[model samples]
Target: MNTFKYRQKYKSNYFEGWYIRLIGKKNIAVIFGITTNKDNPHAFIQYTDSRISKYYSFSLNEVETTNNSVEIGENKLTKNILILNVLDIKLNIKFLNVKALKKNFINNSIMSFLYYLPLECYQEVIYLDGEYTHESDKGRIYIEKTYGKKFPKEWIWIQSNSLPLTLASAKMPLLFNKFGFYCLFEYEKKQYIFASYKLGKIKIMRSGNTVNINIKQGRYRLELHLKLNNTVRLLGPTNNGLMTITVNESLDSNLSVKFTKKNKLIHQSTHKDIGAEVEMKNHS
Candidate 1:
């Protein structure tokens, strides 16, 4: 087994990375190892539905110290954390239980994500590079993916975020709310496929750190290369509870979120308002 490493500094060799668990109910667990160009810090999280397969890692930036907000991001799946000292200068991604999950799954991409994420991602969602409150009711968007050592061959990828705005986002994209999540696994004929189902009913309550989510009916297909950018929001509560999203828009053809599992749309979402905005939480 190769020992994972990380560094935090703006030195000749800046560092940043992290591994996350993909199994849990409410709060996901996260254990992490961080090394900057100069310092190394370790951290963990408190998952509501904690899983045993914890795994995580990350390369720290030079902006972290020890005293700062313990959390980052908003909503349930969001990577918000309780920072000890670091402030706006340092962007720390303390996944609730990211530390343990990374140790459990031990995926290799973690290293790539840490160093490349700062550059590839947008800043905090509040600064809102593209946050908009529009009135174009786009329809529901569906997505499908195959999990395993390699991507699933039968499943392709597609989304329906281009139709309109003001329409609630699809559940597929909301998974970004947490550091860890779960995927369905099964085998067909000769190939093995792992499916990641969306939390049809997700609630990002304002009172607590945890949230609620449930499965929705119906299934769609997508390609292996599809990159999903479904909209996600803290939909108000319903009779059952807080409604993540309701597909009532499909009735009028204007109030639905776009999705795909079997087919692709003519055009894709040109904008992503309810997308992940974790990169902006840094202070450094």
Candidate 2:
């Protein structure tokens, strides 16, 4: 799980970003990204809370990375701790009881064998508990990283460490046609994984302000419904630069998830603080 994903040297048409969400009394997300497009190479930090969203950019030379951490200017993010020092905000948070995905040689990560393939984009998710200065501001946290030449044409991410679930799917280009792939991970008593490589049937539907998604793999099934709320525009990475792609994200979205085995229900719950992101060209 401690794979080095950040770029140390400048490269053309490449970008890597990490989405670190601190889900507590005041939900905050600290996003770090670096785009190496010869013409416009730089690093950035995007800070978002319940009320405001801020972005800071710097030169590529200011970026530092290790196998499990990335630091841009005064902001730094790792597997266990995150430090922020931008503007008047100063925070030092530590992640406790961090639960990461098991890694193997053949199927490196949650993406299965595709983690080693030369895809346009790759994503990895991690769940853990976080603590800051106040106890009320210490709770569950969700972290995900993406690195590649570019993101998929369309994609949706739904995650909640409180619910301990994450579902990410995208329409990836293959030659001239496009194929869909997804990974549904839920941890109740144990981790349940339903992914494309596991012969799963995944469907995503958009209706008005809500999106419905269903996944079936073997005898286990997962159903998710998300309603967008407090949606805001955020910067995403492209081959050109970090600000070229627009991402619609809602940190406090309404989400309902149902997981079952065979014909028996395993878990069903509704959550108000779900991290949801939708990046699409148009509504279908």
Candidate 3:
């Protein structure tokens, strides 16, 4: 598949980016984004680790896309390998036991029917669970991509490779007000899902730096509670420009998740380190 299809079409208010997370000795995240806002269309990269974070900008022409790879300047990303050279940091990482989403009606894309329709923002999962190695430091990794005009005003994103779970809820444009969705596997050796179109109900609550989410669909229920820790601000694309710190990602956060079926516990996990980005309607 052409993961970089949006990059070729130079349209106004268009943006595409790949989110790459490398969990090794230190949790690290890299964002490669290209925006075509007419006035200021450029390609940029953002980096964040436990200690420091930085951003780099280049002309749009610096971005190169292929069948399965996207390269910007000296950095390159593919399904199997990732090469990076920014500032003093360097890595030549290789993904192992990579698991891509199945190619089917619902599994092929997370958006389901909404994927065919044009929306402000569309997200795709490239890799569900994978392992990475960079010399002596080795850990888990997750890969995904987003292409559209701009991000949602409010959203919550959380993922854990150890649990092989990913959940997201965003304020989508159009008839839908706010949508909550999740995809998970390897839970008691079974696959369970909760999505907007699946006739699921979700409730979100926020108090200070802690947030809790509950989703119920038929006989399945998933709950996620998190407390922010070691967070760093990251810029996101907007109609005005790519200057808004729309995302504050927590590198190492406390997360506890529960999955149940038929009013019985199926699986549960607690992790001290996880990847998350959350924005609530009312935060006190």
Model 3 lDDT tens row, 30-80: 987888777777888889995677888888788888778878899988878
Q: Give candidate 3's whole-model lDDT.
A: 0.77
TM-score for each model = 0.21, 0.90, 0.92
Candidate 1 lDDT at 39 equals 32
Per-residue lDDT for 57-91 in model 1, tens only? Answer: 22223223322221222211123332222221122
Better of 1 and 3 by TM-score: 3
Candidate 3 RMSD to the real structure = 2.2
Q: Sort the candidates on lDDT, descending order.
A: 3, 2, 1
* 10 residues in a row with least lDDT, candidate 3: 1-10
True-structure lDDT of candidate 2: 0.74
Clashes of each: 93, 0, 0
List the global CA lDDT of all models: 0.21, 0.74, 0.77
